[model samples]
Target: MGGGWIFAVIVVGLIVAALWAFTKGTPTGRQAGSGSGSSDEVAQLRKNLRVKALGNDALVNRLVQAERNRMPGASEAACYKAAIESWERDNR
Candidate 1:
């Protein structure tokens, strides 16, 4: 029963990755100017990832520590991505 969240997160991650890959090269998908718009999107993505891990305290802790040990900024995304990858690996 507890493993259900892992499966859900994996599915969600895959779907998101597919959508990103599909749109990455499109004209509309390519945003310019290095604006805060992309930063907002990244922040939201990290929030959603963290929320998905909420049901598992251990996972959340690992992500938090991972971020702390990493650089002060641009680390949450890496940490969350690592957690998702580890879930995919350990469960298989």
Candidate 2:
């Protein structure tokens, strides 16, 4: 009976270890950019945008132009609004 209990505990311990290992494992380089499963593209994009907005005039111009292109009626006020929205979304 004691041997059976020891075996059961070992099995449970192995199962838990396997679960932790799988959950904490890193992906391969190709899998990193696959665009759907477990990717960090959105987070990276947000980080890039924030850095650009904070430090680069060229990037800020490009971002503003992109926003204006997407919303033809977007005024300077609208651009500011969109920028604030983007900032809030990322910060939160």
Candidate 3:
């Protein structure tokens, strides 16, 4: 009788774990209705864009400096993005 109870508990535990895994495998996971994505989405997008922009030219310090000078009120990130956009335009 004790062995039967133990077997039942193990089965229940396995079922719970399987359910948890299935839920996690979903596209949105636990945040189905949430408008915002995972916290890293913005950071990942920035990194990916930066990589694409710099694919042809690794040395863009001068361009970034020029962009910063053009937009004195802009933040460093804004200046960098502008420089990348300029680079993409000129290269193409």
Candidate 4:
């Protein structure tokens, strides 16, 4: 009975810790700020890759425009990578 209470308390403590972490985003190497914007860029990149993989020229054009709008300063290497990935996916 005592063990069960201890286990319950441990579980509750873990739950509270998880909630706290969720509310307070985990710290990373990036500066104190720049969390949300970086995450948004990553999310946009993921969406761009998926859309590019669909292998429609019109859609690809739209992806390019959307990406430029999202991050005009983004590297050309990223664009090349998306194209290569799309070609590979389409070929496969």
lDDT of 1 by residue, 2-60 (tens): 79999999999999998877544332232345333355645544554455566666766
TM-score against truth, every candidate: 0.34, 0.35, 0.39, 0.32
Q: Using alpha carbons, what is the TM-score of model 2?
A: 0.35
The alpha-carbon lDDT assigned to residue 19 of candidate 2 equals 80
Residue-level lDDT of model 4, residues 26-81, one tens digit each, is 22212244434455544444444554356465765665566456566756434433
Give me candidate 4's TM-score against the actual structure.
0.32
lDDT of 2 by residue, 10-76 (tens): 9999999988664333321122333342325333343445563686757666665676677887555
Q: Considering every candidate listed, which one attains the maximal lDDT?
A: 3
Return the lDDT, model 4, position 78.
48
Q: What is the C-alpha RMSD of each candidate to the true structure, in Å?
A: 12.9, 13.0, 11.9, 11.3
Model 1, C-alpha of 20: deviation from truth (Å):
14
- Write the number of the candidate with greater TM-score, choosing between 1 and 4: 1
Candidate 4 residue-wise lDDT at 38 = 51
Q: Which has the higher TM-score value, candidate number 2 or candidate number 3?
A: 3
The Cα error of candidate 4 at residue 35, in Å, is 10
Error of 2 at 12 (Å): 59
Span of ten consecutive residues with least summed lDDT in model 4: 23-32
Output the worst ten-in-a-row residue range by lDDT, candidate 1: 25-34
